[model samples]
Target chain A: MFVWIILIPILIQYTLTSVVPMLISFFLTFTDWNLVGTWNNVGLDNWKRLFSDRAVWDSLKVSVIYALYSVIPTVVIGLLLALAVNTRKKGTAFFKSAWFFPVITSVVVVASIWKWMFTAEADGIINQVLGLFGIEPQFFFGTRLALITVALLGIYQSVGTAMVYYYAGLKGIDTNLHEAAKVDGCTGAQVFFHITLPLLRPTMAYVLITLTSGALKVFDSVYTLYNQTGGPQNAANTLVMHVYRTGFFNMQMGYASTIAYLLFAIIMIISVIQYRITNRDVE
Target chain B: MKKRILNFFFYVICILLCVIFLFPFVVMLFGSLDGETKYAVTLTSWFPTQFSLKQYQSVLSVGGRMSRWVLNSVIISVIPTITGVFLDALLGYIFAKKRFPGRQLIFWYFMAAIMVPYQATIVSNYLLYSWLGWINTYWAFLIPGMWTVLYMFMMRQNIAAIPDALLEAARIDGAGEWRTFLQIVLPVSKPGLSTVAIFSFMNNWNNFMGPLIFTTSEKMYNLVVGLSSLNQQSASFNMQMTAGVITFIPMFLVYMAFQKYFVDGITVGSVKG
Candidate 1:
């Protein structure tokens, strides 16, 4: 009875939050409903519109660019940071925490700071610094450069997670493997490439997949920098922002849900591709 | 001599990196002191030419019900995290020790869900919340995040590391599953639980989109949303910085105080699986 009493609230909480929302999403995908009005079955219309919508395609393309931009470099930087810290002269703990500082800081804080940094005016610090080199002040958020800049910030913020995972993986490897390689006259770089890299595959796989998904769904950074307009002229528009605009700004919850589903499908297809590629060697 | 030189260079590099890491704190501190500092260039200003605590004063005073926002965030985040610890532990224990039919399959199901990006479910989730009339309530912010599947999986891995003989002896002594879990598992899994708790709390604290989608009213907003609204309402450099500092403080305090446990918490889950 006591356990049941405790479980009821949790169960109710989960049902209300997770279970119900998932089921409703599935239902809403096949319907034409806005938030304020009645939802009716419009089977395949939303799905069809999803296929033909140029904005959807463009937004998803932006999402892919954003995801790849963040995911790849994040993994590389994370690996380098882990490898750097793993050398362990001293103060590894301090360095580890510092690297993770941005992770805990709200995206709002980071985006706010970066927004100021990328401000287009000559007063913008980035431009001011570049002026010393005689380069004209560039509009970072107004061009494709804006999207890439946002992706770079995403990398900075999220690299800590990849670093932590990689560090953990590094620690788990038997020290003897390095010793054995050293005995065989292998250099440090050689050992890292041949031995450490292969051993860390599982961790790499985990980090890569998670980072990919996170990059795909990234909205807050771009939203904040662009003030939720997807940057100037929708140049930085991503799928999530598209859904957000469709639902909230355009008052087309049905269309937004459709965009959301398209995003879901793309993510799913990419995940499947990643699994196949990452797991092929395992079997 | 060569090795010593290499070590010196390494420390130099590490110290420089540390300064880069600490730059934001420097920016926040100095920016907080200046009443008129706005724009990125102001950060480059060495000292506050005109110092005033009015930013801090007003932030503490009529800061759009921020204190209430913090209180609400705490209630929503802390309650769910506490309850989630128990739920995840219970589920983890079952996965680690118990012999139920389809246990592995069920465990795998949860593990697979970890890979499914939250985007896959966001629309569905919103619709469900709309149907349940949960939109704009604290429950909306708290519910989806509570009882994370990854934490449960991580806890199960940590529990699995404990020797099976310990649990077998408890079982032989005729203790019930729940009792053995309380006595044997909970005590040993303290470090693991703390790690999960800190990670979950941080996730909930910094989450912007969850509240953005969920909370319709300003009164119900968490600090993240409140600060964003503050930015929109006023471009006043001092006020924005003050709000930024207010938002950054709790997390900075937590990170500084519990740095070790937090790092361990993050690395443990990652390393184990």
Candidate 2:
């Protein structure tokens, strides 16, 4: 009875904030409503259109690439960085906090900073650097480079959290394992690959799933960096942005819901599979 | 000797990496003063070409609306964060210490809800907020995001670490539940509370999406939304970076001061999330 008293407020809030909204979003997927119209049944038309829609298909492709590009490098580099800083030595704290700064920063702040750096002009910081190597200025926001540049920003922001998680995972590995491996005359590299790598599997799975999900739903960077529009010719457009533009900007709530549901399905399927694999029963 | 050499190599790389990580911030800091200093970056150096507070002054001016945005960000972030800390800790206490009928079921429901991504809420939330006339109001942000499932999980885990005997003893002393929670549970759980508070503040202060969708007026816009959209009004990178620095300062100071909680939070958070 007492527990219910404590849970009541949050429960009511969650129901209104999350549960009801999600069900409404799901229902909106089937309707023919735009913002101004009364939503009636659209039958399977939206689903059929979603299947054949070229822009949605393209955004999906972009999202996948963005996820892979950001997640893979962040994991690999972050793990390596974590290992490097896993020491209990002086100044480790400073280094840890330094890298972790970006993780706490608002995406808009970081995007704003990076936008100035990657400006398409010849005088832009990055282009100026490239100029020293005898290369012409590159238009980072152009079709050729917009998505990749965005991915780099995403990767930069994520690496810190991944490193922190990996560091914790590394610290949790029993020192005795290293001692035993050393007694067996293993090299440092050998011990890491043989012992530390296997122990960090759970951390890797968590980081990968989060990084992938974050990448899939990425909107702030794209929205901010390119100024509400995706990028030149929609090259940097993502599924989330598509949904936002369709629903809010274009006021096509039903169509936006359809895209959102598709995204939700993709994310759910991936997460379910990940959960099944990662949560194998010890029983 | 070989071990010494390897250690040297590691530290060198780590230092270089830290420098690379901080380079962008350095640019922002110096670039912020660029307006009055009449300086921009050169390959020769990334330092302030000249020093001036003109950019910061302009950013702080009423016309910039940067100060108002900062105040708005504070209200939006701080109120929710403070409220969330209490609510999150309370939920954590109940879920962790109390075992009543349907407790596990309720806990699992929240756990499942955590898996639903933010994108799932955007369309309906927008429509819902619009219909509620919550667009352009802080209520949209507070209502949905006032308390987070992530913080609840963190608090639950933290409080659960305290042995039941602590609570049992408090009860045996004839202490009321509120008294026990306030004097005993809260003191012991300061670290958890701080962790939740820091994360809550960070997320709220930097939150762009909720404000972007919910509020259209300049007065209600938080720093992230207002700061990012500054290019629409002015193309000056110096002034913009100055505004960015203004936004970054509070979070940075809080982080430095409360570094312990952050380290503790990550270690425990890894196991659950």
Candidate 3:
């Protein structure tokens, strides 16, 4: 009875998070409700309109572009960092923790720093760096280039996570195998391809899934740096951002729920596809 | 001799990599010290010529209603972290050691929660909170985050690694499941518990969007949202960086104090069960 008492409170807390919101969302999806007014039953109109919304499509495209820009660089650079640091004999912990710093820093802080870096004036870091080579200061945030820059920042922030995972993976391998390969006259390069790359597949698989999910949910930096407009040309407006704009900013609650569900469906489908591909490859 | 040279090369590479990763943080630290926006505008100035605490003061002194927001954040974050640690351990105990009907199904349901993005349900969550009179209350933040499905799963993995004989002996000695959990399972899984605690605390501390949508008033905002709004409302760079500095301090201090734990917490899956 005492255990049950302890259990009940905890269960209530957990279930509230999942159950209450879920029940509310189910009802809200079929209604014509904005936050300010009384809700009315709208049937499937919100769902239907969601299918053809131009902003939704545009944002979806931006999401895909944003995901691609962040995910690819994150994996590659993260792997290289892991591989580089794995070779280091001393200060590995320091380097590893250094890389991991951005992972913990608030998104707001990172966004602010990046905004300053992307400043349009000649004093901006990128502009100043380019000025030495005589290139004019480019308007980064006001163009499609701004989206890519924001995406780059996202990659920089998250690649550490991937690196840590890969580093852990590298540590799990048998040192004897590397030693044996070296004795067989195989060059470091040759051994890495034949041994290290293949052994790192499990870590790679985890990285792929995580980075993909993270990419799909891109929001904070873009929202902060771009002033919630999704950057110049709406290039950084991801599906998550679209959901936020519709739900909160625009106060179109029902429509936003519909959009959220759609994004959920899209992510599920993509995850399923990736899972099948990876499972086949692993087998 | 060859190994020594290789080690030297490795250290140099590691140092360079550290610099690359730490550059932005270095910049941020310096940027927050600028006395004027003009000084900050000069991006190439690696060091701040004029250092001042003026920004930090302004952020903290948004003065009247801002302190309430900080208090709200503290309550919201603390309640969830403490409850999540206890509940996650409880559920994890049941799943890890308990032989019960339909356990796998229950476990998978919890796992599935992780894949379902908050973006999907946040709209409804907002409505639910308002309807229940939870909006603008700490309950809105505390309730939604308590489940921590991922943490439960992690604890299960860690707990499973423990010897079953220890738990069985406790059970045989007339200890009930609950006592067994507190005595044997909980103590044995300290590292795992620590991992969960750190993560939950950090997430709750850093969360912005959850509080943003649920809390209707400025007084209900978390530190992240408070700092974000402060940044937006501040007219000058000095004020904004000060806010950034104040916001950065607590978490930074936490990280520095619990450096080893933080490192292990992050690398949990790789380092241990």
Candidate 4:
């Protein structure tokens, strides 16, 4: 009874905040509301509009491309870094801290620094370095390179997290298997491929799902990097960014909810697919 | 000889990667110290020829809103973290140890709710908060974020590891349920509580999207949103970097202070799967 009394307030709050909002969002998908004034039950108009929306498709494409550019490198570099620093060697702690520093830093600050460094001018640090090698200054934030540059920033921020996950996975692996493999005349490369890689499957799945979702939902760095716009010509507009822009900027609350549902569906489908693929490999 | 060469090559790669990760902060620190004149040069140097605290002084001055944003951020982050962690710990204890009707169903409901992304419900949350007249108030952040199901799940995992013998022993000692929880469960679960607290603090402090959408007035803005607006308004690189440093220093200090908890939390959270 006491427990019930204590749990009531928390549960009510949760239901009101999370459950009610979720239900409202679903209802919102079926209505035509502009955030102010009255709302009407449009009933599938927003759904139909979503299918024919070019901007939605373009933003989805940009998000997918950005995910590819960010996720693969993050996983790969993170795993490599884990393997390098997993040993109890001298100065490894410093290396770990250095690598993980950006992970803890706020995205605003990280984006600010990157924006300054990649300023796309003669004075920009990156462009200065390029000039030293006699290459012309490149417009990094321009439409041609904005998505890729933003993806690089994503990788830089998150690779540390991926590394930490991989490190934990590496620690969880039984050492006896490695010793037995070594005694059976397995080389370093062979032991890693035949034993270590397979054992890290679960960690790989978690990392992939989190990183992919994170990459897909990325907004802060891009929002900051492009000065509140979605890059030059909407080159780096993500699905979440689209939702924000449509709902807040244009006040198309109903349509934005529809797009938000679309994002949820994409994330769920991809996560289920990734889970199935990884779990099957494990078995 | 072959092994020596391989080890040296490995060390080289590791050092190179560290430098890649740490180089940007070095540039940021130097850039923040450059005087306005040096910062404005067409071909600005990477290293400051002469250091100046003008940017920092301006950002931290009493008239500026940066300090207000910082205070707002602290209030926003600290209050939620405290309340959220406490409620998460309590509910986690109940869910883990107590038996009641529809517990599994309720637990799974919360679990499934985690799948719905914030964007999915943010529009409605915005509408609801606006309806309640909390659009530009601190309540916009504090109420919704006061307790997260995700950390509740983490605390459940933490609390489940406690020995039943300990609880039974407490019962035999005639201690009430609250007493057992206050004395035994919370202390034994210090790691879990601290992990949730640190993570909540970090998330609340660095949160950009929630504050961006919720707060309309500049005064209600947290540091991240404030700095972003500052970024848009200011063209000076030194000022921008200075603001970046100011926003970053708190989180950096938190990370430094609780490095162990961060690592342990990640490891423990990942292992449940």
Please report the candidate that would top DockQ against the real structure.
Answer: 4
Over B48-82, each residue of candidate 1 has an lDDT whose tens digit, in order, gives 77888877776677544877777777877788789
**Per-residue lDDT of B33 in model 2:** 67
Q: What tens digits encode model 3's per-residue C-alpha lDDT throughout A1-283?
A: 5444554575576567776666677778898788987989999998889878999988888888888888888989889888877877456667777887888778887777666666789988878878999999988887748778878788878988888778777878899999999999999999999999988876787687768877888887877777766677777788888989888888899888888887888778766765565556546
List iRMS (one decimal) for every candidate.
3.3, 2.6, 3.3, 2.6
Runs of candidate 2 with Cα error greater than 4 angstroms are A133-136, A281-283, B1-8, B35-46, B62-64, B267-269
- Here, model 4's chain A TM-score works out at 0.93
Chain B, per-candidate TM-score: 0.87, 0.90, 0.83, 0.93
Q: What is the fnat of candidate 1?
A: 0.45
Which is the better candidate, 1 or 2, if ranked by lDDT? 2
lDDT of 3 by residue, B78-124 (tens): 78888888888888877887776667866775676666777788888
Pairs that clash in candidate 4: none
How many angstroms is residue A194 displaced in model 4 relative to the true structure, after the best TM-score fit?
A: 1.3
The C-alpha stretches of model 4 lying farther than 4 A from their native spots are: A271-283, B37-44, B268-273
With a 3 Å backbone cut-off (N, CA, C), the pairs that clash in candidate 2 are none
lDDT order of candidates, top first = 4, 2, 1, 3
lDDT of 1 at A206: 75
- The lDDT leader among the candidates is 4
Residue-wise lDDT of candidate 2 within A125-188, one digit each (tens)? 8888899999999999899999999999998898998998898778878999999999999998
Docking class of 1: acceptable
Give model 3's TM-score versus the native structure.
Answer: 0.91
**Isolated chain A: TM-score per model?**
0.89, 0.93, 0.92, 0.93
Candidate 2: count of backbone clashes, pairs at least 3 residues apart or interchain: 0
For all the predictions, what are the DockQ values? 0.47, 0.56, 0.49, 0.61
The clash count for each model shown is 2, 0, 2, 0
lDDT of 4 at A85: 79
